[model samples]
Target: MSVRWSFSWEDEEWLATRTPPADNNLKLAIETLIVPFGRSWQAVDNYLEVWRNMELEHGAEYSVSTPSAAVERISRDTVEIGDLYDQFEDVRLPVDEFVTLLTDLSAAMRNQ
Candidate 1:
């Protein structure tokens, strides 16, 4: 199957307030990631809603991986990091480091 990868805010608030990426590859990457959760944007949104609620209530973690069963831990770590950020605004790496990490992650996902 062919996949398109792209990135955009899937939430209504962000969607209303922000402009989507103009870069085609970035857009494709975001779309590719959303496909496994569900093939439509709305499905991804619904999953995110449930996921966020689970994180809030029970600190649940979720992962997205190719092969559908590889059980990668990075996504789980990302969730935990986000939780940490919510609890402690000062508990974060530098912006450049965070960007590099995410860039590497996106590369890995693309390779998969």
Candidate 2:
């Protein structure tokens, strides 16, 4: 199955809220990670509602893979868990290459 890997910090907060203790964790995730991306909390709320339904119906697995190894490989400036979409843009990897990378990422996550 294909996955959508967003580096938007807004998206991260949305993911955090899907779990229990929605407010605290959502705040933490936003302040610590999402805020730097210049996202609005209100927009995050709207997107979360939409994404939640999609994930539930389609079984899409949204994930954050900030493994130490991956971080080291990508380097700190661009490899941070909250900056993947930026990295994806910077790297400008072709669609085929990106699919290969995602495939590899999935395999690694599964192995772990």
Candidate 3:
């Protein structure tokens, strides 16, 4: 199945203020997107890794994971912050807020 990102109106407004990112910067932007949106994956890399593994094993037989799945899994103890998996939909937030929130979460996770 195909996946698409979601952006709230506030997220769109916040994104509009920033300049377009280069192709290489897409990963960073995606990471920033998921932070405050309550996604469970630690970073975008985790999401990609999940997708990669799933592709290797199932060859698209199963649906991909998404931010909604992340949130649900986080709530249910199936996944934790900083873990990566496939099947995620894009969840958008302001870059500044996302960076700050993620930084705080990362520190907390490391300390725990």
Which is the leading candidate under TM-score?
1
lDDT of 1: 0.33
Weakest 10 consecutive residues of candidate 1 by summed lDDT: 12-21
lDDT by candidate, in order shown = 0.33, 0.32, 0.37
What's the count of clashing pairs in each model shown? 10, 0, 10
Q: What's the TM-score of each model vs. the native?
A: 0.29, 0.25, 0.28
Which pairs of residues have clashing backbones in candidate 2? Answer: none
Pairing residues by index, what is the TM-score of model 2? Answer: 0.25
How many backbone clashes are present in model 1?
10
| lDDT (10s digit) by residue, model 2, range 19-102 | 123244322333343333233434334434543464455453342322211111132122222333333212212233333333
TM-score, predicted candidate 1 vs. hidden true structure: 0.29
Off by over 4 Å in 3: 1-42, 69-112
**Candidate 1: stretches off by over 4 Å:** 1-32, 37-39, 60-112
- lDDT measured at residue 111 in model 2 versus the true structure, 0 to 100: 42
Candidate 2 differs from the real structure by a C-alpha RMSD in angstroms, to one decimal, of 15.4
Residue-wise lDDT of candidate 3 within 84-110, one digit each (tens)?
A: 444333343332333334454444434
lDDT of 1 by residue, 37-100 (tens): 4324444444445545655665434433322222122333442122211222222223233233
RMSD to true structure for each model, in Å: 14.3, 15.4, 13.2
